[model samples]
Each structure stands twice: as C-alpha cells, then as structure tokens.
Target: MADERLIAALDVSTRAEAEKLVTQLGERVGYYKVGMELFYALGGDIVTWLKGERKKVFLDLKLHDIPNTVGNGICSLLRLRPDILNVHTAGGLRMMKAAAEALHSAAAEADIPCPKLIGVTVLTSMDAEDWAGLGHTEPVADSVLRRAKLAQEAGLDGVVASPAETAEIRRACGEDFLIVTPGIRPAGVSHDDQRRVMTPAGAIRSGASQIVVGRAIYAAEDPRAAAEAVLKEMEAV
Candidate 1:
C-alpha cells in the first residue's frame, strides 16, 4: 500500500488462498502479515514468494520459549529476513533479551536489516471476563502496560497491542516504540471475535504505528475495494 501504516493480514489457511489475496490486493497493499494460519501450513514458501513480489512481511509467529530455545529459533529465522517479527512478552525478560540479542547479532553478521522486534502483549480476543477466567485478578490494561514496559526494557522495538491501549502504550513507551494494533473494526463493521475493537481512524488517532485488518478486507466480496476503503479511512486521519 502507498501508506506504510496499514498492514493487510494474509490470514488464510493455504498457499493458494494466501496468494489469491496477495494477487487480488496487488500494489494497493505493500505490507502483509503472515500469521500462524498460512505460515505453519506453507512455512517459508509464502515468505519467499512475498519477497519475490517485493512486499514487506510481518512474521507473526509470536515466539515464546526458554531463553536459549527462543534465541535459537530467532537465529533460524534470519534467512527469511521478515520486515518485522513478533515475540511473546509472556516469555519473561531473559527470554525476550536473548531473542533480541540473537536477532541483532545475527542480522549484523548477515549484513541485513535486523527485523523490527515487537512484543505480543495480550491477545485482542481476551476481555475482562475472559481474563478473569485465566485466574488472574489484575486488569487487562495494567497487565498490558506492564508487559509493554518489560518489552521496552528488554530492548524490543515495540508491541502488538490493542487500539484501546495504543495511546497509553505510546505515553509509556514513548513515540518511537512501534505500536501495531489489531482488532480493528471500522464503524458499521462486525467486530467478529475481537473483544477490544477500534476503527482504523480511531486506531491511527490513538497513535498506532500500524494497524492490522483481516476479516474486514479478506472476508469481503471485493478485497481490493475493501482495502481501498480502509486506506481512505486511514488517510482521512
């Protein structure tokens, strides 16, 4: 896309389906997110294809594991050279630090741009009710902010957070920290499974560095037009 702030999610389940969305949207969308659905199915095949097409990739594996294991996993991803990569903040300070160190050193050694490392704070699907079911008493916003701070302290580039928390995250993490908000449902659009939702304009005005839209575009009858409408909404901000 002409605007660098919007990311179109390739949330399909197959390579053929993923490519269809890519071809359909074409040049209007320059950045695409490869989440677990398509990525686990096709592995790096789709990433390579996107690279061939000169589109930026957000490899949303949300890696979380032991410090050494996570570091090694990130090292292994050096080959795809995704534009941005998300790791889980729930992995703790050591794990996040190790992953950041591994990515930075590996990228410097390989002479490539170290993919922007973002922390997954909290899933947008979880609301206060769902969070309580997880057995914690803390408010979701408090936990999300805490994790965002932890991510910053651990040297992550930013976080994948909800738009509802975007402004607070910006205030806490500062202007440079990348805030990639999902759960974006424009007005008159279904929120789907997203519990904390905001419109594209609201997300942008809330200070999101990037917003990810999936069903709103990919699920529409005409994805290109849907994406164009989204861009227009974003541009109006």
Candidate 2:
C-alpha cells in the first residue's frame, strides 16, 4: 500500500493524453489526481471514466470559502464520491470543520463512504520569501507545520505540503496524519514552476504518505519509465 502512494498527476489538457497516461502508469499508481484544469474541462466524467478503469481518483479542487458555502460545496462534491478530496487550510478551522461535517452527513444520507478530506497548507510555487511577503515572518516550514496542525485539529485526514517539510509535519502532526507531498521531482528532471522540490526517495524518506508528481512524469521522454523509476526510488527508501 505504501508503494501505491505515488500519485501520477495527469496534467494533460485533453482526455486523450490523460487516458494514455492512465493506461501507462495506472498499474503502478494507485490514485490519479484530477486537478482544476482537467476537472474544469471534463467535469465528473473524468472521475467516472477513471473508476470504470478501476482507478481511485483524488479530486484536488482545493475548495475554499465561508463555512456555509464551503460546506455546501463539499456536500455537492460528495455526490461524485472521489476517493480523496482537499480544501485549503487557510480557510480557517470553522470552515474546515463545517466542510468535513457536511461531507460526512451527505455521505451518510447518500449511503456512500465519505472521501478522505485533506488540507492544502501552501502552494508548491511559494517559498520562504513569498511567505514573508504575505506578512508571515515565520519560515515556510513553520507556516506549513502550523496549518497542518490546524487541519488535523479540525478533523482533516491529512495535509498537502511540500516534500521538504514532510518530516517536520510528521513530527508535529503524528504518524497517523497523512502527509501528501506534491513537489516531487525525479532525479535529472527540471523543477518547472515548483519552488520546494525533492526526489522520490527523498520524499518517502521524509515521511510522505503520498507524493504528487506532475511534469517530472508527464513531460518525460518515456513517462512509463519515469514512473517506474520513481517507484524503484520509493521502494529503495
């Protein structure tokens, strides 16, 4: 199951590319992340198609709003019944709690299992200076830890953080709290737009329950080989 934590991000714009990646890496990856771009273009059909192929989907909408609005949004998303979902921890404890409760309630009423609710601590695009510019004097690691704790307290299943902060988050949030690291770059891969990055082995060693890899795999000359390499690295750790 630990090996299955490598989520290959299908960052393609079209369904053809998405389906091709799924076909190539689906056996190696347990879950495929459907982020905003693909979700916006294809809607729930993407999740449905993935399920048809026996793949668990993580819908990374990162929903954020007032407590009532976010709760309503989660209630709606619950109908799609993804394996996992996420909201921004910056949404505050009340919003997070409300969203969780509403999702659980909706799932119960619909006779469906509730999706594991995760929280997004900070975007992988930002760094320490970015946080400082946002009026946060604390280091990026400190800020991530703080948000992760808040998410756990509000009953979230885990948090999405950079791989660099996985160890600190694990130490602060406990072993059971899932840490999904997104800034994973395989060896020799370009960092792209992500600021905080780590290799697959490094991410797993840092205590990541799952690692979200986008460009590193999708943009590779041989995506299947790239994914397999990442799996081997993770196994080595």
Candidate 3:
C-alpha cells in the first residue's frame, strides 16, 4: 500500500542536513514537513528544492498574526506551493478564514492546486496545565475540540493535533476533515518535550489522516531503517 500519509518532520537547520536526511530516507517517506527552524535557515528555496526532487512539502510555519498580515503571509507562501500549510487557531476565525481565502485566490491566480490549510489547535508539548497557565479554564482536550470546531467553520481543511485528541477532532469535524498528528512516540520511546503522544499504529487507528515523526526517526542510528520501521508499523494497521 502507498503510505502517503506518513510525513517526515525535517527539523534540521541546514540545507545539507535536510538533503542528507531526504537522501537517506529515499522513497520510504513521501511527505516532508519544513518547520520554522529549517525554513528560517534555508528560506523558501528549500521548498522549491524539495519539490524539484518530487517530494511533497508541508510548510508548518504555524503563521499567526493580524488578519491582513497572515493573509499576505499565506499568499506569499503559496508561491512555493506546499502540499500542506498551517496557521495558529488561536488567531481566531477571522485569521483562519483569511488564510484559507488567501490560499484560494493565490492558487487560482497561479493556476496551481491550493495547499491544504490546517489549523494548529494545541501544541502537543503543552498539556492541560499548560493551557490553564495561559488562562484557559478548560482542559487541553476541551480547548482542542473547541478550536477544531472553529477551524472547520473557518473553512480550514483540518487541524494539527495530538493523537490523543484525534478521535474527538474527527467526531467534531467529521470524516473528511484532515487530522495531522504530531508528538508520536513509537511505544516505549521517550516523549521528550511532547506531553501528549501515541504509537504510530495507535494514531492511525484513532483516525489520524497523517502523523509527523521527528526525533524518533532523525535521532535514530539509521534514519533509513527507522523510516522503514515506521512505515512497516503503519502497514500493519
């Protein structure tokens, strides 16, 4: 089976580093997530490079700003034509809607397929206490649910959430909504900074459309073998 849903989080900081990992992982991974660290380091050309090599890109900058700025940011990023892009849901309905609309118009004008615009509900690194510290009385999952609802209403393709909340998000957003899960620790692996986590197979069973694996693969002794193991695990499901 073609496992297009497995996204490799290229969290490295240099073009050489990202290139080496992509070469090592080869065909086992189809999608690559370029987040702030690498994007800031290499700029958008890295996206162009990845596409040249025929790999899909997920530009996870999590853009959050005033409506107009975020809209322009989305329009600018659309030129790279990432397969997926994201914004912070905390920016609220106006910002999220602006991003979606911006992508729509830009892609239409450019004559390219618009990227799937997803909303970031809650970072897996933060738990309930973390949200409480931010002044929210509700638990983390509750807030994620509320945000997922708002994301759908804002015309977002879906949300980036932890595996623990994938089921609830799916229930709230319905089957077609995309659920991209990060903070995945293959059973018994250390959770690191992420507080909410699930195994690869567990996340798939929970209705996650895709899952992001960072250290689990990047920090492994053999990144190719590590990626293959993750794909095998997903295949078992």
Candidate 4:
C-alpha cells in the first residue's frame, strides 16, 4: 500500500492554530492541507512557512471557474509550488485540462516538480438526496464513479472522494490513480460536517492512497497522539 498518511487538514482560522497542529503532528503526517479557512487568513505565506519547516503542503483551494480564469488561478497557485493541489471536477474537461497544462507549464518555468493535481468529485457532506435534488438520476456512488472517470480522462493525478467510494474508484480508474479521501472519522471521533465517513483502517483497506483528516486529529485533546494513532491504524491495514 502507498503511504496513506497524506495531508492532514488544518481547518483552523489562524496561523497559530495551524502551526500548533503542524508542530504536534508534522513528523507523523506527510503533508499539511491549508484549506480555504487558514489559507484565506494567512495566504500563500502559510505554504511557504510549512515548506520552511520541511513539511510538504497541499493547497486545497478547490478552484472552480471558466477555463481561462481557472487556468490563471491555477498558475497563481503553482507559483507557490505545493506538493499537491486540487480542482473541482465539475468544472468540466476543458477547465481541468487547462489547469493541468498550466500547472505543468508553471512547474517547467520555475524548474520545480509539478504538484500532483487531484479532482474533487463530490463533497463528503452531500448524500444521495442532495444529488437527487441537484437532478442526478443515478445513485451517489454512480455519480462519484462517473466524476472519477471524467477526472482520470482529463489527465488528473487522481481524485478526492469519500472512503465509501474509494474501492469502486480504484477498480474503475486503475491501481495507480491516487484516491485522496477526507470523510474519515476514527472509531470514536465525532463526524462533524462530514456525512460519508469511515475509519482510517477501513479507508486504507478500501484502497485509499491518502486520507485527509481534520477534526479527528486537530480537535483531539492530544493532537499528536491522535495523529500517531491514525498512523498506527494505517500501518496495521
């Protein structure tokens, strides 16, 4: 199995909270995800700070826009040179392809390794009913599969999906297509805003290449211990 201990989302509102979590679990986690919350507060400097501390970063802005606009946005983010980045697959093939091409061009220009670009299929917070309301006639799993395939066809590195759909996505997209799941709730942790969640071991067993956990680690009384427990669970799987 690939190292499943990937980006641990620091879903805080300030640099201090993010940095504290980084200090606690930085060594255990492979990458730290600076999502909209923290990124909005601290900007690209957060990524620069994490890099300065020798930690890989995943800038999860989930950029979505027209092809040209999204491409420009991706180029802006590529300048930061994060280890990973993502865009909503719903943006269509042209947007995704443009983003991918821009990322490669930016990396080549900067003489840096291109960041792995993943696609967000569906927010884990949404369910079958939510999709149905949005006019999706198929089941949630089917929709997720469709989006994953679209992302793969668009030349994305992989997708960010719920753990429940990871296995199916793996089978459909092939073994090497990265699966980064976020709706992970350890055995006793609260689910919070995530609706489709699984345990770390279960996610790994389902063939998820990487897991992005937030509250299960960040909200724990001992964040480092929580992160270590997750690593142990991943290793066990």
Who is ahead in lDDT, 1 or 2? 1
Off by over 4 Å in 2: none
Q: Which stretches of candidate 4 lie over 4 Å from their true place?
A: 1-4
lDDT tens readout by residue for model 4, 53-74: 8778888999999988988898
What would the per-residue lDDT of candidate 2 be over residues 82-196, giving only the tens digit for each residue?
Answer: 8889999999999999988988889999998889999999999998888889998888888888999999999999999998899999998899998889999888888888999
Q: Write the per-residue lDDT of candidate 1 for residues 140-193, one digit (tens) a residue.
A: 999999999999999999999999999999999999999999999878889989
TM-score of each: 0.98, 0.96, 0.98, 0.96
Largest lDDT belongs to which candidate?
1
List the candidate numbers ranked by lDDT, top first: 1, 3, 2, 4
Clash list (residue pairs), candidate 2: none
The 0-to-1 C-alpha lDDT of every candidate, in the order given, reads 0.94, 0.89, 0.93, 0.88
Ranking by TM-score: 1, 3, 2, 4
Which structure is stronger by lDDT: 2 or 3? 3
Clashes of each: 2, 0, 0, 0
In the predicted model 1, the residue pairs found to clash are 1-29, 1-30
What would the TM-score be for candidate 3 when compared with the true structure?
0.98
User: Model 2 residue 35 lDDT?
Assistant: 96
TM-score of candidate 1 to 2 decimals = 0.98
